[model samples]
Target: MSIDANKELVRRLVEAINRDDAAAFEALVAPEFLLRDAVVPTPRGPAGFREAAAVFHAAFPDFEETAEDVIAEGDKVVLRWTARGTHRGEFLGVAPTGRVIGFSGMAVFRVADGKFVESWQCHDRQGMLRQLERAAACEGGGGR
Candidate 1:
């Protein structure tokens, strides 16, 4: 596919994630898709990808990621994004603090045949954890 096509594919996937459109998420990702990120523990396929999304939604019900930039070359697309959400549910064992959080990250996706085949992502996990920890402390609670 063309570079623009690859970028569009990624854009649609992000939109699907933000909208929590399960069908679109499933359709956009290949059945054998693999997501490599610090946050995902299991070896992931499309279903696993969906599960990861569920985890995020469970923690931040209104989670939204805005793409700041998207660049595509060959079959790979790189996206820089910022995400914000309210912590309303447990996340990775961290109790909900009802705090709004924001973080930035970047992801590189390998698209094949118009489907996401693989991805590698990096995010400000430590910063997020610190923010949550501070919130927890302020609330007279301890963080994990």
Candidate 2:
């Protein structure tokens, strides 16, 4: 596929995330695809990716993902995006604090045969933690 086509595929992936469409997500990913997130501390394959997405969806039912920009070269597509959602479930061992949070991240994807075969993502972990801390404060939970 061309660079434009790869970029479009990445865009659709982000859209699927915004909609929390697991089927769409699965369709775009290779069966053995690997996803590595800086905040997660480990690499996750297709099944693991699904589990992670499920946990995020359950935590933030109204999650929205916006792809700020995308750059494609060869079979690699790099995506910059921001995700906004309200915390309503456990996240990173933290209990629900009912706060809205927005975090930005950049992900590099390797596509093969029109499907994402691998991805490496780096997100604003400290920023997310700060937002959660602020939310906890609003809920009368002590400072972190």
Candidate 3:
């Protein structure tokens, strides 16, 4: 596919993710797609990817993602994004603490035939952990 087409495909993928549209995500991801996440412990395939999204949706019911920047070259697209949400469900084995958190991340994706074939992602894991810690403390009626 052309570079523009690759970029468009990635754009739609991000839109689908932001909407928490599992079906749309499934359609856009190749069967062999590989997802490497910084926070999550496991590398994910399509099913795992879907499960990861479910985890995010469950933890942050009102999660929102904003794409700050995107650059495409050949079959690869790199994206920078920020996401914000409130903790309402379990995350990383922590109980719901109702903390609001935001984090920024970057992802590089390889698209083939308009489907995401592979992705490498890095995010502010330490920042997220700190937010969770503060929330837990608050929920425990302690001042940080």
| TM-score of each candidate structure, all chains considered together | 0.93, 0.90, 0.91
Candidate 3 C-alpha lDDT tens digits along 1-144? 888888777778778777888788778888888888866644455666676677788999988878888899888999999999899998888788888899989999998877888889898878987898888988898788
Question: Candidate 1: TM-score?
Answer: 0.93
Where is the poorest 10-residue window by lDDT in model 2? Answer: 38-47
Query: lDDT for each of the candidates?
Result: 0.87, 0.82, 0.83
Ranking by lDDT: 1, 3, 2
Q: In every candidate, how many clashes are there?
A: 0, 0, 0
Model 3 Cα RMSD, Å? Answer: 1.6
lDDT, candidate 1, 2-91, per-residue tens: 999999998998898898878987788898888898786546677877787787888999999899999999999999999999999987
* Total clashes in model 3, counting residue pairs 3 or more apart in sequence or in different chains: 0
Query: Candidate 2, 20: how far from true, in Å?
Result: 2.1
Q: After superposition, how far is residue 27 of candidate 2 from its true place, in Å?
A: 1.6
- Ten-residue stretch with the least lDDT total in model 1: 135-144
lDDT of 1 at 86: 94
Report per-prediction Cα RMSD to one decimal. 2.2, 2.1, 1.6
Which candidate tops TM-score?
Answer: 1
